[model samples]
Target: MLGVAGVVVAGAAAIGHLGGSDSASPTVAPASAAPVDENGVPILSLPEPDPVEEPQDTAGKCRADRGDQKSGAGVIAAFNFAYYNQRNGEAARALATPTSTVQPGPELQRFIDAVPLGTNHCQKITALSDGVYLVDLSVMRPGQPVDRGTQTVTTAHLDGRWYVDAFT
Candidate 1:
């Protein structure tokens, strides 16, 4: 009877040794608590997307050459073509003065917003002075009658280039 009891004790010890050690078990990380509102509803927070930068020049090449910039009528033609036809504000701004309203800002945004749904064509350019001109514009808006009006455009010669000084 004593020998049988010793054999039983040895067998139990062998089984316990085969169970596994603490290091053999996989470690599990504790879950973090999510953010909640007053009613315990989870609140989601996302990061803002980055802004896209527009190129200074486009494939159409709306910028006026030196000879065109030398003439007020030419400059106005190029500016109107770029601003009203192509809807290229940057290209139009290149033909404007540094302090002109066509610069990239709220003033420029207003012009961009006011662009017609269809197209604008320069009809006639009458020289008011050596550096100024009266431009006759034909505006065509979608689902609207064609409208014709005249605007005063002033030009300035700077650094061997002519820039639109003021437009009204």
Candidate 2:
């Protein structure tokens, strides 16, 4: 799992140097405001997730709920949907900060592009509070046609939402 996360993050970094594709942004609107209905009505309060089940606490909002053993599946799914849907331009604009940069070279870029194609999935999580975590995203590298990786992430509670600060 850790192996997979490493691959995904390093890969993204690599591709990033080719230039952050405007398409690499996320589709979802920032989760800062409120959970709105289709009609745009605001949702006040929602139930917190079961710590034993979800581990992530919903006392806050967005992807802020995170704890040990958490899969970060939400992050993975959301990121994929956003980028794959072509909503990545402005979404990535938010990451244009000093924290966003790639190292480990172009192998990192190929690693990212090769990630999803490898059938890697989030295996487990190690929570580091303040919306940060170590996510294990990988597939069985049992000599199968697959690649693996891990990512050390730092997420920030910004605008009442969890925004990825950095991944490496």
Candidate 3:
């Protein structure tokens, strides 16, 4: 009886091995043959990446001459020209007062790094007070729209020179 049972088990195993088309087996399609939706669009398809813009070389683009430091607007113009157009932190800092927010440190370096490559132009300057003014500035970059903004610049007349006391 045991020999008969062993023969039956062996015969069942042989039958399963011969039948290779098992319904329980999982199927994987190649990448090129990805599954499609009802609309015939590939389900695994990804959108094309956006084109990356290269950084513009802004060195030597700014004028070597500084703005007239005698007026509050002039000092502000000089500061903006140095910081944004020239990317010169030291030149910008030179126009700032001793206790001004524009100081030499990581913060200054961060400002230099964050300056966009463009031409910084002083559009208009309106005197708010004796040594304070509202400056309308615009930045122009190649193949881009002009960016316009306003900032308040406070100047101090110390040691017979106008220096940027605060900028906001």
lDDT of every model, 2 decimals: 0.68, 0.47, 0.71
Q: Which digits, one per residue and each the tens of the lDDT, describe model 3 over residues 18-106? A: 77846443333342577889999778867889989995432223322356587676677678777776787887888898899777845
For candidate 1, report its TM-score: 0.53
lDDT per residue (tens digit) for residues 141-167 in model 1:
777787878778889888988888887
Could you estimate the TM-score for every candidate? 0.53, 0.36, 0.55
Candidate 1 error regions (>4 Å) = 1-67, 103-110, 113-116
> How many collisions between residues are there in candidate 2?
17
Model 3 TM: 0.55
**Candidates in order: C-alpha RMSD to true structure:** 20.4, 25.7, 20.5
Task: Itemize residue pairs with steric clashes in candidate 3.
Answer: none
After aligning candidate 2 to the native by TM-score, how far in Å is the CA of 38 from where it should be? 40
C-alpha displacement of 2 in model 2, angstroms?
74
* Local lDDT at 157 for model 1: 86
